[model samples]
Target: MKKSDVLEQIRKIGLVPVLRAESESQALALAGAIADGGVTCMEVTMTVPGALKVMARLAKERPEILLGAGTVLDAETAKECVGEGATFIVSPAFDEKTVSYCRAHEIAVLPGALTPTEVIRAWDAGADVVKIFPASAMGGAKYLKSLKAPLPNIEMIPTGGVSLATAHEFLDAGAYALGVGADLVDTKAIRGGHPETVTAHARKYMEIVKGFQAGCLI
Candidate 1:
């Protein structure tokens, strides 16, 4: 999908499941479970072994879902992920080279940034979204709200410390979306082969977001 369309989908969904799979089979299963729960945007972190292979498989098999590569740290990895069908790239820190690579490839990039300076720099470097790493450490929703007055156009996705309860808070605070990890997909559940727990959690979150949208319409 095009970058703009992917971004729009993410905005509408209000949450992106950040996943880490140990094997290709597990990765596909997790993707299926999340997709079934109404989450179409996923970020498969590169921290896991054989991440590239898993990403490639998901890209080929699930053409409808928007696949993103996360934990990308360098230019080479970013380029490789884009080639492997990553519609968007995310990093834990702001890297100019990685941002450049994504922009050159016409793929969306969300480089992690904490302070306003880093956020602005990432935007200047062409990051489609600036991820606020460890967002909870800086007051989470409150911190994001502080930036809206000055940088309303800078799309920010708050990762780390975002839970189902606080997901809506982030969006209401002007975050483009929430990047949910452990809280949404418990590692123990995945390792124990009970992906249904993750699916249930995803469904609950989706319901909360949908309710919030409904309230807005009312």
Candidate 2:
């Protein structure tokens, strides 16, 4: 898919589930559960065992769903993930090299930043979108709103503290999309043989995003 289309789909969907699993099977299970609930995009973090294998399999098995590689720290890892069919690359922190690589390769890159300085630097460096990591620690939606005050043109994905309760608030605060972790992915639910639990969470989140988007429609 074109890089522009990938980003547009992300904003249209308005939810990016961040997946962290114990094993490849668990990751696949989580993806299936999320997809079943109407969410087709996810970030498979490098922390999971066999992360590359998981991405590869998902890319091949679930071609309809958009796949991204998360916790990508450097250019080399980003390149490998792209090779494995990651259309987008997400990182917990900004890496100049990684941003450059993505730009050169025509891939969407979301590099994480916290303060205004870091966020602007990443935006100026050509990040497709800036991810506000650990957003809850700095004040969640309020902080995101503050950042949007001056940087209204920058597209941002708030990566932490997003949940069924706060998802609407984050969108109201100008989040282009949300980067959700345990709240939506639910590793315990999947690992404990309760994939349905994760599916339920996905449905609720999808509802939240859908409602918010519907309200925004004019």
What is the Cα-based TM-score of model 2? 0.99
Q: Choose the strongest candidate by TM-score.
A: 2
lDDT of 1: 0.85
Best lDDT among the predictions, by candidate number: 2
Error in Å for residue 67 of model 1: 0.2
**Residue-level lDDT for 93 in candidate 1:** 97
Q: Whole-model lDDT, candidate 2?
A: 0.94
Ten-residue segment with the worst summed lDDT in candidate 1? 182-191
Give the Å error, residue 114, model 2. Answer: 0.3
TM of each candidate vs. truth: 0.93, 0.99
Q: List per-candidate RMSD values in Å.
A: 1.5, 0.7
Clashes of each: 0, 0
Question: For residues 6-40, could you state the per-residue lDDT of candidate 1 as single tens digits?
Answer: 88888888888888766767777888788778887
Writing each residue's lDDT as its tens digit, candidate 2 over 1-218 gives 99999999999888999999889999999999999898999999999999999999999999878999999999999999999999999999999999999999999999999999999999999999999998999999999999999999999999889998999999999999999998888888876799899888889999999998999995
